[model samples]
Target chain A: MAKFKVLAAALGILLVLGAAAAQASGVITLEVEILPGFRISGPGSVSFGSLHPGIPEERELQLQVWSNVPWQLSANYYGTVEAPGIVEVQGRNGTWIELGSSTNLVIWDQPKTDPDGVVIKVPLRFTGSFSHDPGTYDIQIEFAVVPLL
Target chain B: MTRVILAMAVLLLVCCGQALASIAVAPVIIEADQVQAGQVFTVVCSHGGEEPLEVALSLALFDQDAWGRVILMEDEASVARAEEALSLERRRFLLQPGQSEAVQVQLAHADFQHLYAVLFLRPVRPGPSTRLAVLFLLSSGEGTPSLDLSGWEQRGTDLTITVENSGLCHGFWAGELLLFDGEGKLAEKVSVQSGVVLPGRSRGLQVSLPGWVQQVEVRSLQLGDGS
Candidate 1:
């Protein structure tokens, strides 16, 4: 009986040690990701206040960009509206600026460090010094963010 | 005596149950669409377990050899230390419980159209590791290769090992070789002649064996996209 008791206690100790070893080796692996993420939001559309023939108009819309890394923003206007005179939109995305038609303009772009929200004034201007047709110009501008990787 | 044994057995089972708990990684693959040079791809790694976790992050390549098997590329020193044109930030972190974190990876350069890279997340504590492969340029419209072993012929105590790669891009294969005698018993097991085969191309490897080789088998252990 004494011998049996000792053997059982030994088995019990072995079992406990084995369980502990297994526990020490158990690890949960989580998927990994790199840094630098951005959430571009605020102001769905850029709207001009009002327009007058032979008169220039300017309006500012707030475009906010939230970034996790160094980033730059660029914009391009689709040539959807075709009306008299010269219709060109001029503005700065954040710092880098391009002044032209059907061209992507680089606004305020350099590099970033953290995920912070920065708002920029996206201005729309229409210079109608020489008017050929007078009407409402419906334009669509697309915005994109480029991060320096 | 019987009671003591029964009690110990029950205690062991209870301990085993508690010891086996683990955390999980979601979307174990990072498949990017039409990625090119200087293109940035983002992936979100969500933690799914009862406890919060901390992990060490690293990169590796996963591949298979002549045999059909999935193996990590870093199992060997050559493939593990091979330089790649890749960039990433935040190498390690302590993730909050039940929270998903985002990681940004950029392909700085690619010698081939398609690239395969695995992001390894090893838990700081005891748990399983997640290997997520980022298949680059899959949107290049070309299909992945179907690598296989073909054309087995014997040459007087030697064997010709051939690998056929049928795809638009190249394939890398490496594994072990198993030799069997005429009696259908295992004879000798040797490391396979591993190498890269070009697309639509077949290459032969000559492996010398020790005795009369009645049967030969290949066990593909690693695989990856080759430039």
Candidate 2:
């Protein structure tokens, strides 16, 4: 009986240790990507806010970007377009919809080089009536990463 | 008694395994949208898991030679001692789990267009070394305008049209501006030069538009005006 009791205690300890080891080794990885000039809008709409001549339009592009891995992520729009009578707008309200308000923003951050990274996709839409003029416009994009909790 | 001894040995092995022969560390993540040149950037590093994790964080910049091969941009002969000898400058940090620490890095003299650095996170524990590659750009705000039609205006009988270069970059090289009427028909077209806007500057020119033209559409020769 004495020997059996000792064996039972030892077995219990072994099981506990095994459980702890398994728990320590479990981990998950995530990834994200964002193409600066890429837009997912529809036909009859030229992205980067250029209004062509004579087309009735209504569409929006929105994105919401966030990081799950203890990182603060954000979107920065540094591009420009110079065509008079054409309206342009962008900001970091966590909501970016080109047309209607509250259309649906996306979570941004998906760089091709970041494997084992978390990706949050945003909705990008475009709608416009080219009732103005036509010309080539300039667009700029810059992405940044901050490592803070 | 024999069974008990065997079980005890097994428990010891399991506990030893839990101690971690090597740690599995994750690379740090940073996100920013378009960093400006000569701007100061603060990066934060956070550790995973509960309880404070002890780690030694190190940073280094890659030095490339004239041929663009990786070389330690410095020589040891300049150092007084081996321990104090440095190839590239390095900064160290101590991070606690669930906590983030920020470090400031400058974008001075570094080409805002091509700048990338490497960050190393070495676990004090016997784990794998995790690393992060950081990239940034500096915008001098000196890019030329893709299209500028500032000189064309509607006058009484004669419309004066001027083609001006209104950008921070250099000249338009060679391009033509075509004017269209409100009816979507081509009206007047002219070539332009001599008006270029330097950084933080602007210029103007003049031209004449037909009396019958109501509204105007300006476009380039590479692809005429219709946005």
Could you give the fnat of all candidates in order? 0.00, 0.01
Residues B132-160, candidate 2, lDDT per residue (tens digit)? Answer: 22322223333433444445455553544
User: How far off is residue B120 in model 1, in Å?
Assistant: 1.0
- TM-score, chain A only, candidate 1, equals 0.57
Error in Å for residue B89 of model 2: 11
> Residue-wise lDDT of candidate 1 within A1-149, one digit each (tens)?
99999999999999999999999999999997644444433433334434444454555645455554444444443233443333344544233333333324344334443445666665655544233333344444444443321
**Model 2: per-residue Cα lDDT over A52-138, one tens digit each:** 333222233322222323222222232233222222233335444342211111222233223333333323322232332334432
| Model 2: TM-score for chain B | 0.32
Off by over 4 Å in 2: A1-149, B1-38, B54-90, B108-113, B120-122, B139-227
Q: State the lDDT of candidate 1 residue by residue for B1-96, as single tens digits.
A: 432222210000100011222233333444444467677766665554455667556665544433322234544552343236566777777767
Q: What lDDT is reached at residue B206 by model 1? A: 75
Cα lDDT over the full model 2: 0.34
Docking class of 2: incorrect
